[model samples]
Target: MALPERNNEGFLENAWQWDKATAEVIAAESGISLTDDHWEIIGLLREFYKQHEMSPPSNRLFVKAVKEILGEDKGNSIYLMQLFPGTPAKTACRIAGLPRPTNCL
Candidate 1:
């Protein structure tokens, strides 16, 4: 299958183009070997985008949402950082085929 189109930052240009394969490609490009835990966050990010019409604007807000949905253990910043490394919200959004968080730089 053809690769989905992506922006300069490697986010999918069209969110509808996202799929598990595409997400794996993006994750691989980012040096991530996706785990079940990573997929959990990606699914949550996609759902969050569907409801909010945007990626969470800040890490704090993302963490809060995760806490509310997945509980405190997964919602903590350190755990998220461990999963996504540099910037959990931005990295997960990219892998999830969602737009970059407006507040992220």
Candidate 2:
């Protein structure tokens, strides 16, 4: 399928255009396989965007938010980093089809 327009970093230009197929393509580009674990976090990020209309804004906030919702076992940096290498929040938001986190790099 023809994916929607994306930014230089591969985040969807319009989040409303996102879907599972689009996420799969983007995750493949990032070398991610999107297991259930990944889906759990992606769902959280999507819901967060739906409610707050923005990404977590930084890795710290991402971790904190996850901890708040999913608890420490899933929310810690090590766990998140394992799922999304480099900057966790940035990579995750990109794959989740949300706008880039404001304080992420």
**Which candidate leads in TM-score?**
2
lDDT of 1: 0.91
Estimate the TM-score of every prediction.
0.95, 0.98
Per-model lDDT? 0.91, 0.94
lDDT for 42 (candidate 1):
92
List residue ranges in candidate 2 displaced over 4 A. none
* Model 1 lDDT per residue over 1-105, tens place: 677888889888899889999988888988999999999999999999898888999888989999999999999999999999898899999999998888877
Cα deviation of 102, candidate 1, in Å: 0.4
Model 2 RMSD in angstroms: 0.6
Please give, for residues 1-105, the per-residue lDDT of candidate 2 as tens digits.
899999888989999999999989999998999999999999999999999999998999999999999999999999999999989999999999999999997
